[model samples]
Target: MRENPTASADRDTPPTEWSVDVPETAAGDGGSDVRTSNDRLLEQYRRRSRKKSAVIVVIAALLVAVWGYAVVTGPIPVSLSETVSVLSGTDTGTAYQVIWNIRLPRIVAAVGAGAGLAVAGAVLQSVLRNPLASPYTLGISQGAAFGAAFSIVVLGTGTTSGSGPILSVIDPYLTSVSAFTGALTSTTAIYLVAKYKRATPETLILTGIALAALYTAGTTSLEYFATNTELAALVYWKFGDVSGTTWRFNALLWFVVAAVTVYFTRRAWAYTVLNAGDETARSLGVPVERTRLFGMVFASFVTAVVVALFGIIGFVGLVVPHIVRRLIGGEERILIPASTVAGAALLLSADTVARTIISPIVLPVGIVTSFVGVPLFLYLILRGREYW
Candidate 1:
């Protein structure tokens, strides 16, 4: 009877099937959601990269446009069609002479000098980790100035012809050599201090100030004893000009600039990592002291060459990098090249204005830059903490 009851109960309870409902997320939908999120993020990164590339491309285009404008612009008039014709060798007239011999060289010189100095400034700011560091502020230009002044006064390498707003140098080569010598000397001193004495950036900056003062005093002493013509010539040379630059000179300057640009751009990562701090950079296998010293040497070399060839063009090395950094952020890879192009454009624009601003008077390019740079520099200083 018991067996019959148990069997009947089991049969009645029966046939109950157990089932579990799995969530959709547990069915791998969560992984799919994750992949979708990753895809979206990758697309966003690509878009940003494309935008940044486009910006650099746009800046390059603007530089080309400025170059074209500069080529056609001058005391002598040349139309766009004529410029193209001249370039194509189809037209060999007065426009050709002016554009080919006069304006083109000067413009090209401006471009090379601007790019060189600007890139140098960028490197200095990064490696030295000083916002105020530049060829000018660091006394390199002043050192070059003293060299040129000494050449003019002591070495008797300077001579002037043509009076009243006209300047001619009898021996630009000798002057340039002396200027380079002086600049290198200054670089050597700085390097020695940085290497052996282990001077901090602040101390080096003070050294620059002292060197600047010493050089300025030396220049002044030379100027005090100079004849009036020599004085005028010295003043004119210090005014920073690209006028009368030859194709040969431009070739040399451009070659140096291109080499330096390649070097600096390739080392962008080093400079960028250096910005994290010297100790951090050293930890990352970057030679902190060596990088700083060599950077100064190369930067000073470029500055000396530019200054020797074109005179003391302040603010290009000092201001253009700061301006470019503000536009593109401090990523040295992009910053260096952008500063190169922007510097060329800015100096060319300033040179153009200098040519046209006072008409026949033809102000010094340095003066125009100073007029623009001083105000811009002040403004940048006021707001620089945001970027630098």
Candidate 2:
């Protein structure tokens, strides 16, 4: 009798049986095989992610400790123990008052603003897929500046000359409102421009840059025509001081930060899907256009609030996200939260250095952030080019 083809093939291959019931050799088994493969891959990824997260947490803790030390042991030279005691409300003295009341709020402001701007930057960069994208690059900051300048140059001057009570004549609330309005307006314009032919990254970046230039020019013209006292006020505002921020201001800052953080964090999953390309995201049931629009608007609102309070603190949004991306990879789920923490630490350290580098003559927080951010950003660009 002639040997059967299937039996002959099996026997020639190996002594091991190749039955249809064999788990690894079964035909029409692709679904199960794929599931197994995916399960293994996912487990490996989770393990790697856990290790990376631990490392990041340790690094962040160390940085925070260093920043705290710098804040305390500045030009004034307060001990670490004394700083902790003061912060914890167990210390009582003029030194405590100065640190707690004056420096503390400034530090808080820096941390809050830095984190907010950084997250905004990361979101925009991922959504636009453009490295040049940032809060300023997207025209939000310029729009905010215009609103603030308008209020200071026109409304502020008008009220100052005829003021009975400063609060009654012109409220800071109005300035913030104007900034928000301008920010939304600019955001809408950019979105409309970018959405013309399917929302390409290049188109969005170009539109943002064009609108930013226009807003900046408008702000400059306003500054030029401002009255003498208004000019002085506007100059101070433009430098982005964190000094003299009150509890009320801090509360407002906290509220806005919390709102933005919660909103972005919830959308972290959507952002990750979004980074995978619009077509892919849409195929997977993501409303690509809606998600992008919502994220941009929410981020713009945050930027507006920050600029309204602190003036134009540039580069934090641009620099912080790139740094975070390098540290944590391009997954927005990780990038968003990581950027927030890293940005806060960076700004806190910068603020500490700024205040102590010249005691009683503190530099603008904006100046300090840029001083540190620029060199780091340049290094990133060089490294990024090499990587590419």
Candidate 3:
């Protein structure tokens, strides 16, 4: 049998009738008026919560549909069954090579990167208590971009290819490593400065902006020194396309995405408490400052790894979570996963359009997302007349 959630709360509430005339609506048919108002409101919320859960399930189904669409419709449209056959190793020849070696990896990378950015944004918004807070808001993307540029332009780690009498294939590993290091350094700088002072929203955000400006200047300097070939490569990477993702990089991206999602999802309760404000969180025995620091740092790590592999996709961390919050409520349990799936779908869809819209002259996935997000975000805000 289903249990009544408000039963215990009703029992626990003290009589309030002697103090003031109880509102007629406060009492139930059972005449249990003591806590009926609050209990009834909570029950109403529970009903709405159930509805939101159903919505989340539907959103998850949409993610699957988007994934299927991504897999089948490309430059050479492969059927879903054929794609499955290729994956299952029952198919052979050029079809398998094209799907497995190219389309599949890029699709997977797009989904993973989008999901990672969305989840990271959710975490940052909760911790920072700022609607605008995101991976980019804290300068993490710029830092990662600067690092990738350093490796690409200064070190020539991923750009020394298809030139001269002898082709030189630059090791992609060094570029990834440098990008990670630069991202970590920027994040660590923010964390350290915040810890030394206080990890308040204002302090962390200010520190991030400063670091972002520094990184941007450094990147500009690097671009000034770079040869035309190097500059072109750097610009392409910064445009945030997921076209040339190799199996090795895609594998690592998936690993990080899985790990980050699991970590954040498990800490869902802590995030809820944190969102309630520092004093309330402290009252609930949550380590407010430490939790905020961990959330920001890990979120930054995910963003860095993604930008390292896929370049600097913006507004994902900023837009997706807000969209999730708008569609679903801000309960961490639903918000995190829903944002992730929605984000994955958004990016994969954007990447698909990027590849096909202009035909051979593929646009960057980032550009597509930005073009789409700005209008959608405005619609959401204008329609609601309330911030997410």
On lDDT, the candidate that comes out on top is 1
Tens-place lDDT per residue, model 3, 34-151, is 5676678878988988988887788778878877777777777678788888889999866798788878888888999999999998988887676667787678888988887887
Write down the worst ten-residue block by lDDT for model 2. 160-169
Give the range of the ten consecutive residues with the poorest summed lDDT in model 3.
160-169
TM-score (C-alpha) between model 2 and the true structure: 0.81
TM-score of each: 0.83, 0.81, 0.80
- Candidate 1 lDDT over 127-182, as tens digits, reads 87877778887788889888877877888875666645434544667777787788
**CA RMSD of each candidate after superposition:** 11.6, 7.4, 7.3
For each candidate, the alpha-carbon lDDT, in order, equals 0.80, 0.74, 0.79
Sorted on TM-score, highest at the top, how do the candidates line up?
Answer: 1, 2, 3
Candidate 2, residue 90: the lDDT equals: 90
RMSD of 3: 7.3
Q: Model 3, 25: alpha-carbon shift in Å?
A: 23
- CA deviation > 4 Å runs, candidate 3: 1-46, 160-174, 188-210, 376-388
Error of 3 at 302 (Å): 0.4
RMSD of 2: 7.4
lDDT of 2 by residue, 38-111 (tens): 66677799897886686468657956785666557555667777877887889888669768776677777877
The Cα error of candidate 2 at residue 193, in Å, is 2.5
lDDT of 2 at 260: 87
